[model samples]
Target: MSLRPRDMPKLRDQTLRHLDDPTSNLRAKTGDENATGLDGLASHLRVGGLYWVAPDMAALAMSSGSQLAAARWATADRPTPCGLIMFDGGIGHFDARGVQIPIEACAWGPYEGECMLWLLMSRRRLVAEMARANLRLDEEQAPPLLPVHGFTVPVTTQPAPLADLDPSVPLPVIAALAASWLLMQQPNLIDRTRERPDKSVRRSYARAGREDPEVTVVDLRRQYVPDTADPDSGRDGRHYRHRWVVSGHWRNQPHGPGQSERRQTWIESYVKGPDGAPLLSTERVNVWRR
Candidate 1:
């Protein structure tokens, strides 16, 4: 069951009306509490050498999942529904100190940033969803779905050797695959499309297993689903456009002589569309029960 669209504003108002949190000095969106945690997260990422900071969302805007409309959710801001995907194994909540705060995802919603839930999603679940839709992060976007918002980046195509490792492919490749998959999965009223699949990427390949496995590929890309749409996609004619990000690591190892081996390629791209932004059947937001 979900809440009606008209009631969303009321709910938001109700949530914001009360701000007296007796648990800790932390008030929602003050950015102070999350700031500390974000600091901890930053330090952790820097030491781990996962990827670059500053320019990326890991350094830039931080917020909760699909629920929050805005990107930046620092301090005392309207509580953005948040889920912590820790650097260590498992998805669990973390304290301002960046320590894991044991909690259920079901519990994550109601609590503001001060007490957000960090969850570790199952890779198995992701695989199953992909399979259900005949979607493979590895394969190219089957059809109907194609890039919409991004400009094309042309690279002379070449055949990959048999010795080439997949390493979950490259980041740009991951983005393309994910964009197509996510768009197709998004619900449409007219076309009567499917609901958004619950997908999460495990960035830590080591925890994901198989490090430097010459033959096997390790998919360590972390992606986030941002809430957005083309103004026209929605009410214009009742169309829907779903957007998402795919990030991961890949290294193309030159099989033998004449082959050029590249360094760790941390590729990421923004992908969207079903050729045209598919129209939405309805704009009613569903409020599920906790």
Candidate 2:
């Protein structure tokens, strides 16, 4: 479950209190002494990769499936939570030296930076309650409060040929396909309305899968589940429809008449529906690859 809005201030204060304490020294602790193995596991996990630390209380307090299903944790959830609390506003990486490397994400929250501080504060509170015999949890096995977060985007989108595109492009496409994906986080100028499906929209074609496949016309809007998934879709179940062409060229062929008849492919956009009412538009572009 997400943190309650009413408790945000208290939670932030508790986290800051532990982090500001000079004696806390959460980052300096060794593997055996430190609850988080950030320093010890940095090399193995790769500092640039995403990592997370969560307080014990967060586990029980949050939804079992929904919380973990968040985009950040969906791909990187680990059995054990990391303990190091970073001081920056986002993810971080270390250099050759043990010096801290600060990285920031587009979004910010307590879990982003100073996560350890929050965890520590929660733990201290739990320990205090236990000492007073007020803790309802078992002494030997209290639930773990883990911070939910992770890394994404090793690089941004760049030019690529359909045939030359890395196979991994589909993964990011999958990410984009999800309704909760970050692509829709920003406001876009598109008015989507839902319409009853005329039928199970389907398209198929045969192509010589040589160096590349010929452009295949695909109605992305029809393929998408606007009713349940597409964020742009209106409540009525209708949404704007756009036509896209996944094109490719033969490996041995060039773009001209003199080109060899090889298999090459690329995408062509025939229609767009954002800036103005839906209109015919054509543009040849390669799909994004990871």
Candidate 3:
């Protein structure tokens, strides 16, 4: 059945409860690697940041890897501080073979195939509960919840497509495209690494009679380098280059055996201008925090 607006909260709570239950078999089946990426993305999501996934993107994600594909879509926007995936469409469930099937088609309640699903990383309560249950083992040692939780809300109208996305494209390929774009815009932002908790965290775990867990941390940094002199303004004293920001976009990249396969890659946003030149405009990113 289609989710009711009033049932959103209960659905969220129920999903979280399932995820929190260590023994529950009803877990989101995003692959282990994708789950790690989703968990890391969740931890970085700003408290109140809402990332909207267009209907087409949501469909592509579901077709690709369900929750992880959705996560990849959410991160492609590079929502700063933190963000949650607010997908407006029908809910889906994974089959025994790990393929996504519409929830209504399963042995569940009837759904109109029109709804909004809010998916986010349960970074606090669920994580804490799992940690307590696992006794401070590393993530590899103790696989936490899929780290992604979701709920659905019924919508009266169908969602409109935000962009022309090819349903045939896999989510990972799109993710790689988004990553390429992000790398160009803010190269340092992608520097994610896994390391053991700091001394204080380790000590806290020790006090609790547990060992420290390894955590994935991303280093967020942005740098603006302006040219000292305009290359176009040489000798002739003509201002050939003005300060401008290059828009972010995706391009096809060749790969695979003999580079025979082509994949989508994102081009980063960059500033182009002579050194010390005044910028015609600047890009602003809005970040929401708890």
The candidate maximizing lDDT is: 3
Each prediction's total of clashing residue pairs, residues at least 3 apart in sequence or on different chains, is: 27, 30, 11
TM-score, each model? Answer: 0.15, 0.23, 0.30
1-290 in candidate 3: lDDT tens per residue? Answer: 43222222223334445444445443344445444333333333312232333344334333333212222223223333233333335334323255432221000111233221222322233345467667553443222223333322222222222233334323333333233223323333333334453566567657867544443222332233322343334567555356765554445456669998554443334555676667775467422111
After superposing all C-alphas onto the true structure, candidate 1 shows an RMSD in angstroms of 23.5
Please write out the lDDT profile of model 2 over residues 84-126, one tens digit for every residue.
2211122222232553322211111123332111111133334
Q: For candidate 2, what's the RMSD?
A: 22.1
State residue 129's C-alpha deviation in candidate 3, in Å.
17
- In angstroms, give how far residue 163 of model 1 lies from its true place: 28
Better of 2 and 3 by lDDT: 3
Off by over 4 Å in 3: 1-189, 197-213, 221-243, 255-260, 273-290
Task: Report the lDDT of model 2 for residue 124.
Answer: 32
Which lDDT value does model 1 have at 185? 23
Q: Per-residue lDDT for 177 in model 2? A: 19
Q: What tens-digit string does per-residue lDDT give for candidate 1 at 151-240?
A: 111111332221232332222322322222222222320121112111221223345562321111112223334323332233555433
